[model samples]
Target: MRFTRLAGLSGIGFVLLLLGGNLALVSAGFPTPSDAVGFDEVARLHADASDALRLTSALLPTAWLLATIFAAGVFAALWRHDRIRGDGWALVGLAGILMQCVAFAGVGAARLAVATTATHDPGTASHDLGAVAGLWGLHNALFGFNQIFLATALLGLSVSGRRAGLVGRWHAAVGLLGAALLFLAATTSPYGADGVNPLALFGLVGWLLWLVWIVGYSVVLIRGVEEEVPSALATP
Candidate 1:
């Protein structure tokens, strides 16, 4: 199959993974770190013995793996389209995505450790709870850094795609807007501090729109691949 089709399918799958993870967390009543005052509370909410909580913890790492695949597919599509033109942005975007994925995996691992501690050791739960909170803070900090790299990847793709005529100016513009908003959010996130920012919430809105754009972009690429098939098949 064409790289475009692969990218489209991967993008769809990535979105599904995110949605599924969020749903699982919500079903388990998992509290956001902001809501939980300390490690003990974090453990109480997220590291519970309930099956739903375990599912929620598992979904986070699984989602990161899916994101890595999605990023790889996007990188392949971008490189296929722009490499002949000597555009380096595709590689830049790929590097940024890889960084984001690795950092996210770290966060997932930390979260999983906290969950494991909470599940297996009731005797040490109180004593180790503070350490788990520190881990949670580290995870949040990692997430904030991940968003910065994610924004970089998005911006790189937007500029490169527009220059290569792979996508329209307006489409690229929307991507730029989304990336800018995310960058702002990343900068204001305070390196994973617990308190919230209104700008970060606004950035979340942009992120939502940005996700919609990705889905639409993937559909366009998939259709382009469909259009190419007949011509390739008809060639002698």
Candidate 2:
């Protein structure tokens, strides 16, 4: 029970960290996916927002850690349920979350490299716009592909959770809708390699839905802790 409550708190913490990091990046002039810009422009942006970029990069690892814990908690909660048992959906969801952590690590590394290079090695960055652009492309690709993992997590968890009676219909619907949009976004990712594509709107909307679904899930976990305790004490 205590561990479940801790997991719930970790989920909330993960959401807060992600929200804060993104807001910081936006405030520091991080470009949106729809904003097409050249390598020189990319370098300039990174240089200008070096502090925010570095800070966000540093914070993301912790967020990912919390995400892993939350996923594990969810899996534990559903593992013994008859509907989830032998289905492996909980494991699938856990795998998806873990993969997202790996994919986003690459994204963060690319961003941090660009920021560091632009800030500390301006001369090199100026002479080699090609390399800088390559980094930016890598970042965009990773970001786009990362949505696939998010979709997978949503699908696996929402479906299994619903069957186990751990997720309400509305919550499951949100997850399914978010999953569809995110999967569509991933399919169109190649077109957005340059970081400018109208299809990116699917990703944007899906990401917002993902946030809402996670918050709802976190609340469920937190509330479950209260409900489980009374039943646990009465058993045997």
Question: If candidate 2 were superposed on the true structure by all CA atoms, what would the RMSD be?
Answer: 3.9
Residue ranges of candidate 1 with Cα displaced over 4 Å: 33-36, 56-69, 80-84, 121-126, 191-198, 225-236
How do the residues 31-106 of candidate 2 rate in per-residue lDDT, one tens digit apiece? 8776788778788889887977887888987999899888888888778677679997778788888899999999
User: Candidates' TM-scores?
Assistant: 0.80, 0.91
What lDDT score belongs to each candidate, Candidate 1 first? 0.65, 0.82
lDDT of 1 by residue, 155-236 (tens): 8877766655566666777778878887887787774445443366656765675677577557656666345433431222
Q: How close to the true structure is residue 45 of candidate 1, measured as C-alpha lDDT?
A: 61
| Model 2 regions lying over 4 Å from their true place | 121-127, 225-236
User: How many steric clashes does model 2 contain?
Assistant: 0
Q: How many residue pairs clash in all the candidates, one count each?
A: 0, 0
